[model samples]
Target: MIVGVVSDTHDDQEAVAKAARLLLEQGAELVLHLGDIVAPFTLRRFSREGVKRLIAVYGNNCGERLGLLRTAESLGYEIHDWPHVVELAGRRIVMVHGKGPAGETRELVEALARSGRYDAVLYGHTHEVDVRRVGSTLVLNPGEACGCLTGRRTAAILDTETMEARVLEL
Candidate 1:
């Protein structure tokens, strides 16, 4: 199964739309957003035809939590708080925004990957692309889809069968 990973969209509709299209073209069956969506309108951009599901977590900048939840529910999407754990394609995965008052930093993300509790740990906050393996787990941060900080809009495609991921420039 191919899973698309994205993060820190930060309300860039153009980037979000492009990212979604690119992921779908890459044959992504599901798309995961690590958060910082910013607003409900930005969340709607994932409503593309080919995506089977869109799951997102709350980031530090997602102040309008209620609105995000409502929009997600209406779109038949799934939105959760930080550290959301789920199993996809028979692989255990944990998704987090990797920031906020809880101080979920890069260390925390690495720790989760090293713990061997999950097959992949996906996070974003620093808006930097990071893809590596810790023991038997994969730790990935798809960078900033908004291109606000890195000046490069990007996303990622993860192959569950091989447990490999590649960053794609949007």
Candidate 2:
């Protein structure tokens, strides 16, 4: 499976659209959005005019933005309300928004890995793309789609068959 990953799309419409377009052009079978999808229209517009199959977690910004989920729903995507688990290509993945603390991202993955509950962990908060293997599991972050902070819009592509991750700058 070709999985597309992105996070912290803090409401940059153009970058989000471009990222989704590239993912689709690459024939991504699934897209995992890490979080900080600021406004409803971010996801809403994507659903209406861009992406198709998207697995998204709500960010800290999302909690403060009311009715955003409803907007996304109306746009045709189901936003996962909290920590979610999904299976893809025989691999289990745990997804989170990553709002706990600085080093908590690693801790969360470590804890989850220790439980043997998942084969991969995906989270977003820090606007930095990272891919690391933790024991038997993969820890991945797709960075920020908005490009507000880093001045570069980015995303990730994970090839399940090879267990390889490629970062895409939009």
Model 2 stretches astray by more than 4 angstroms: 64-66
Give TM per candidate. 0.95, 0.89
* Cα lDDT, all candidates: 0.90, 0.79
Q: What is the lDDT of residue 7 in candidate 2?
A: 88
| Maximum-TM-score candidate | 1
lDDT per residue (tens digit) for residues 67-149 in model 2: 77677566666678658898889888888877677488767666776776778788888787778877877888888888887
Predict model 1's lDDT versus the native.
0.90
Q: Candidate 2 overall Cα lDDT vs. reference?
A: 0.79
Candidate 1 residue spans exceeding 4 A from truth: 48-52, 100-104
Tens-digit per-residue lDDT, 1-170, candidate 1: 99999999999988988999999999998899999999998877678534558999999899999999999998989899989997988999999897643345887987898899999999999899999999999999999999999799999999999999999999
lDDT of 2 at 98: 78
